[model samples]
Target: MTVTHALEGDVLRRQDPELADLLLGERERQASTLQLIAAENFTSPAVLAALGSPLANKYAEGYPGARHHGGCEIADVAERLAVERAKALFGAEHANVQAHSGSSAVLAAYAALLRPGDTVLALGLPYGGHLTHGSPANFSGRWFDFVGYGVDAESGLIDHDQVRTLARTRRPKAIVCGSIAYPRHIDYAFFREVADEVGAYLIADAAHPIGLVAGGAAPSPVPYADVVCATTHKVLRGPRGGMILCGAELAERVDRAVFPFTQGGAQMHTIAAKAVAFGEAATEAFAVYTHQVVANARALAAALAAEGLVVTTGGTDTHLITADPAPLGVDGRTARGRLAAAGLVMDCCALPHADLRGLRLGTAAVTTQGMREAEMIRIAAFIGQALRDEASAPRVREQVRDLAGAFPP
Candidate 1:
C-alpha cells in the first residue's frame, strides 16, 4: 500500500487521532518535498512492516541462544538471520547487527580495540570527519588523544602525504578512515597500509557509503579494515541503526564490545528490518538503483557547478555532493534556509579549506522515489534560483511542488 493509505488505515489513527495527525503530516511533508539530506532515505514498505512488528516489544539482551531474558527464541532467530545476511552482503567474516547508530558503532569499534589515552588518528572535523572521529566535545576526543589529518587545500582531496607524515610522527594506536561530508571514495587499502606501519588498528567508519557498498556501487572496506562500522540507513535503504563487520579473529571481541561494552539489548525489530534491507540490497535491481543514485549525484553536481556554486572535488563519485553557494550570493547557512523555503531540503557542511560552510546533498532518497538525472538538473536550477532571490521562493516552491508531486516518495 502507499504510505498515505497505510497511514490512513493505521490503528494509531483511530486510537490517537491527534498523534496520528502529526504522523500523517510528516508523511505529507516527505512526499511533498525534495529530500536532499545526505543521511536520509525511504525504506521499503516491507522494512517498515518489520520495524512496526511485534518484535518491538521483545527485550532480549544477549546473543542468539544466550539471551539475558526469557522467550527469546524468535528474537534469536531474527538477530542470527540479520547477522548472517549482513556478513554475506558485505563479505565480512563476522557481523554485529546491534549497535544503535553510526556513532554507537564507532564507539564500539574504539572500545573493542583501543584503550583510554591511546593516540588515535582520523580526518579532522574541519576536513569533513564525523564527530565520533574526534570532535573535542565528543567522547572520542575526550577519552583519547586524537591526531587529525586534513584534505589538500587546492584539490579538496585527502592529503595522503600529510596522512603518512602524521602516522609516522605520531604512531597512533588506531587509524579511522571515514567522513560525514567528504564526497569521494576512501582508499581503504592506503589506510590499512598506514595502520600496519604504525601498528595501529584500521577502523573504517563506512556509515555513509556502506549502503552503496552493499549495492556494489562503492568499494568495500571489509577486506582491509580491522573493524568496519556502518549505518543500516542511507544508501543501504534500511532502518536507522548501526552494525559492525570484522574478521573471525576479532569476532568475539567485537560482539562483546557491542553488547556489554557499549550497548545492551538489541532492537530486534530494527535488526529484522536490517535483514530485510540487506536481502533487498543483494538484488540486481538494487545494483541498478545504486548506480542511478551515483549518476543522479554526478548530474546534480555538474548542474550546480554550471550555476556558479563551487563544487567540492569538482564533482562527486558517489551519492553525495558538497558545494559552496557563495557565488549564488549567500553562505551555506543562508543557502540552506533559502532552499528549505523553496521546498529543497539539505544540510550545511564545513568546506575543507574554506572558512564558510557548504551545502551537502544526496540522491539516495530522490533516486528511490524514481527521480533521475533530469530531476537533479532541475533541482540544481531551483536551488540557484532560490539562493539568488528570496522573493522568488513562492514561485520556486510551486514549481518544486509540481516536480515533487510527479514522484511521490
Candidate 2:
C-alpha cells in the first residue's frame, strides 16, 4: 500500500475513546477543510508509523555508534539513515537530524557560531521574519544584539542595499536570512556577499521553503550560506522535527552544539520518519509536488486579487501568499474567522509598516492532495464569498467539504 493509504488504518480507538475521539476529530477536520497554514503539511503513514514505533522508548544521547547509553544499535542505524538522507537530499557536506524542533535548531546554530552578547543582523519579526530571528522575547534576541532590517516600502521585498549597509555598520558575528511569512524569493547570494564582506557567518533558515529547495524548485542556500537550518515537516511533509546542514568544515561544531550544548538524546523515531521524508523528497514525484505548490500559490494569489483582495508583493514566488482585505474595510481577524467558518484554515499575519493584519495562506497541503490551479481559484472564491457574507459560510462550508472529500490526504 502507499504510505498515505496506510495512515488511514485504525489506531487506539478501543483503549482510550476520549483521546481517539480527539485524534479522529482532527483527522476529520484535516480531511474536510482547506488547510492553508504556511508551515503545516500532512505526513505519510510511514512517517506516522515511525513516530509511533518503539524507537521512542530509547535514549541515544550522542552520534551514531558513539552514544552515551547502551542498546542504541537500532537508534544508530535510524539516525545514520536520517543523517545521510538529509545530506543527499540537500547536497550538504554534513547533516544533524536530531534537533527536537526548528527553534531549537536555530538556537543551536547561534550557539555554534557566537558567544553571548555577540551582534547579528537579521530580518525583523514584525516584518516577514521569525521570532527567533530577533524578537525581544526569544533567547536569540536576549543573548545577542540583533539589528533587524525589513522589506522595502513600495516593493514589499527585502532591501538588499539596506542589509549591506547594516552588515557594514553593525559588524555582526553572524547574519540570518529567511522568514516565516515572506511571500517572495530570498536573495541568499546577496546575503552571502554581505556576510563575506563583514567577515560574518551566514545562516539561512529555510524551515518554510526547504522542500522547494530540496526538490530543486527553489534556489538553495546550501552552496552560499555557512550553515542552514530547516524543519523536517512543513513542505517536506515529514514528522515534526528539525535538521541542520552545513559544510564539512563546520560539521563538527554544528554537531557538538546540537548534542551537548542545545539538546540531548536524539528522537530516533522522528529521525526515522525524517529519513522516510528525505527519501520521498529525493524522488521525481516530490519535485512535481513542489512545482504544483508554487503554481497553486501564484494562481490563488491571482484569484484573491480578482476578488479585490490586496496581495503582498503583487503575488508570491513560493508556496505562501499574504493578502490583506483591509481595503474592503473588514477587520483582518474577522475575515480570518469567517474563512475558518467556511472550512478554510489560515493564519492572520502581521502586515509590515502598518497597523493592519493580513492572511498568510499557503498551498503546500492542498498541493500534496494533488490540487492545481483550478482548485486554487475555487478556494479563492470561497474565501472572498465568505468574507463578503458571513451568513453564506454554512453553504460555502458544504462546498468546501465536497472539494476536500474529492481529494483525501
Candidate 3:
C-alpha cells in the first residue's frame, strides 16, 4: 500500500472508532473545501507520518548532548537533523526547532534579547502585523513598550521614511519587520539599515513567507537580520510548529531562551516532522511549487481586479492578496461567510488606514493541493458571483462544489 493508504489504515486500526470517524469527516471536509487561508497549508505525507510517529513518546528536556532526561539518543538525533536541515535550507549559522508555534518562537526571541519594559518597534497591527508583534492583549505588548509604524495611506505600502522617523524617535531595543497580510515583498535590507541606525536588533518574522523564502521565490532575512523566526506549517508545509534561526553569536542565548525560559520539554515528534519538511523543501519540486504559489496569487489578483474588486497594493508579489469587497456591495465578514458556504475558505482583513472591508486570500493551501492558474480563474469567478448577490449564492456554491470535486482538497 501507498504511504497515505498505510497511514489511513493505521489510524483506522489504532485510533478510537469515534476519533477515526472524526478524522474521516475532516478529510472529507478538506477534500470539499477550497482552503485559501494565507497562513495555512497541507503537509506532505512524510511530514505527517513523522508527526504521528512513536517519537512523540520521548521526552528530551534540553538541547542535544545536554538532555535532562535519559533514553534520549534517538530524540537527540531527530532534533539535530532538524537543526542541521534548517541551517542548510536557510543558510543560517544556527537553528532552534523547539518552539511550539510561531508565537512561541517570537516569545523566545523576545525573552532572549530583551528585559521587561524594553521599547520595541513593530508594524502596526491593522497594517498587516501580527498581534504578537505588540498587541496590547499579548505578552509582547504587556511586557514591552511597543511603538508602531504603518504603511503609507496613499500607496498602501510600507514607507521607509516613516520607519526611519519612528526608529530615530522611538529608539526601540528591537525593530520587527514582516506581516501576515501585506502583499508586496518585504524590504529586509531597508529594515536592517533602519534598525542599525537606531542601534536596535532586527527581527524578521517571515512566518508568512517561509515557504517562498525556502524556495527562493522571495528574499530571505537570514542573511540580513540579527534573528529570524517562522512557523513551519504555513508555506513550509510542515507540522504545526515554529523555529528560530540566527547567527552563531546569539545561538546559545536563543537555545536557552527557548528551553528554560519559554518552554519545557521539546516536542520531539514535531521536530522530526520539521526535519522531514526541511528535507522536502530542499527538493526541486518544492522550488517549483513555490513559484507556482506566487503565479497563482498573481493570477487570482488579476482576475479579481478585472471583475472590479479593489486589490490592495494594486497587486501582489507573494502568495497573498488583500481586496476591498465594498465595491462588490459586501463587507469582509459577509464575504467570508458567503465564501465558506460556497466552499472557498478565506479571511477578513482590517487595514490600519481603512475600515475592515478587505478580504485576504492566499494561494498556499490551494497550490499545495496542485491548483494552477486555470483553477484560480474558476475560484475568482465563484467569489465574484458569491459577493455580487446573496440570492445567487446557491449557484456559486454549486460551482465551488464542481471545482473542488475536480481537485480533491
Query: How close is every model to the real structure, measured as TM-score?
Result: 0.99, 0.97, 0.97
Evaluate residue 268 in candidate 2 and report its C-alpha lDDT on the 0 to 100 scale: 84
Among all windows of 10 consecutive residues in model 1, the one with the lowest summed lDDT is: 1-10
Greater-lDDT candidate between 2 and 3: 2
Q: Identify the leading candidate in terms of TM-score.
A: 1
Count steric clashes of candidate 3: 0
Instruction: Give Cα distance to truth, residue 172, candidate 1, Å.
Output: 0.4
lDDT of 3 by residue, 1-409 (tens): 1133643776574867677767666777777778898988888778878987999999889989999999999999999999999999999999999999999999999998999999999989989989998998999889999898999888899988989998999899999998988999999999999888889999999999988999999999998889898999988899998999999999999999999999999999999999999999999999999999999999999999987789998989999999998888888998899888877888999955887758998999899878899989888888888888777777887777777777664
Residue pairs in candidate 2 whose N, alpha carbon or C atoms collide under 3 angstroms: none
Please list the residue runs of candidate 1 whose C-alpha ends up more than 4 Å from where it truly belongs after superposition: none
**Deviation in Å, model 1, residue 284 alpha carbon:** 0.4
Worst 10 residues of 3 by lDDT: 1-10
Q: What tens-digit string does per-residue lDDT give for candidate 2 at 122-176?
A: 9988888898998888898799999999898887999888999999998999999
What is the Cα-based lDDT of residue 391 in candidate 3?
Answer: 78
Off by over 4 Å in 3: 1-15
